[model samples]
Target: MSSFENVTVLTKANVYFDGKVTSRTVQFADGTKKTLGILLPGEYEFGTDVKEIMEIQAGELNVLLPGSTEWITISGQGEFTVPANAKFKLEVKTVSDYICSYIAE
Candidate 1:
């Protein structure tokens, strides 16, 4: 991972857990392959397991889950749990980072 300004640049795509971005390949329903990237702190609405991917273009933030009725905030670290085909939003708390999050859906 690389950091420029306040955003961390992702070297390889992987699964996001807690505060760690691991190296792995995520498959979507449409069969698109994506290598994960930097996860800027915030809220993300991953519509569901089928929604495939999310590209967060900001840093330090709050995220709204796709199908849920709640707003979650992340300071230094956070995790994203996506069900199949969920749609959501991200509320950036600090400067934003450009994270390319992709899924198979």
Candidate 2:
């Protein structure tokens, strides 16, 4: 995973699924933002307002991406994308750490 040295934090954090997932937003020097988070072992469905790239930093995730029937397994150091205004489901077999980058539409 890449480090965000000298980045600015958004000053607010996000919690989802009753705290099963939580993230803090940070902005790069170029004005790009990303959320760094962790997910406990469980199933979760997420919706995106913009295109998102989810990069796994630790543990494993089984993901059912939009427009797909098969669940793809992504381990630590892997990544996946979800389109704008779309949804995807994830099944975590172990505690998972991730970084999500949002792409402007």
Query: Cα lDDT of model 2 overall?
Result: 0.91
Model 2: lowest-lDDT 10 consecutive positions: 1-10
Best-matching candidate per TM-score: 2
Instruction: Show model 1 residue runs off by greater than 4 Å.
Output: 1-58, 98-105
C-alpha lDDT (0 to 100) for residue 50 of candidate 1: 57
TM-scores for the candidates: 0.42, 0.92
Q: Write the per-residue lDDT of candidate 2 for residues 1-105, one digit (tens) a residue.
A: 458899998777799988889899988888788999989999999999999999999988899999999999987779999999999999998889999999997
lDDT of 2 at 53: 98
Whole-model Cα lDDT per candidate?
0.51, 0.91
Candidate 1, position 102, lDDT: 52
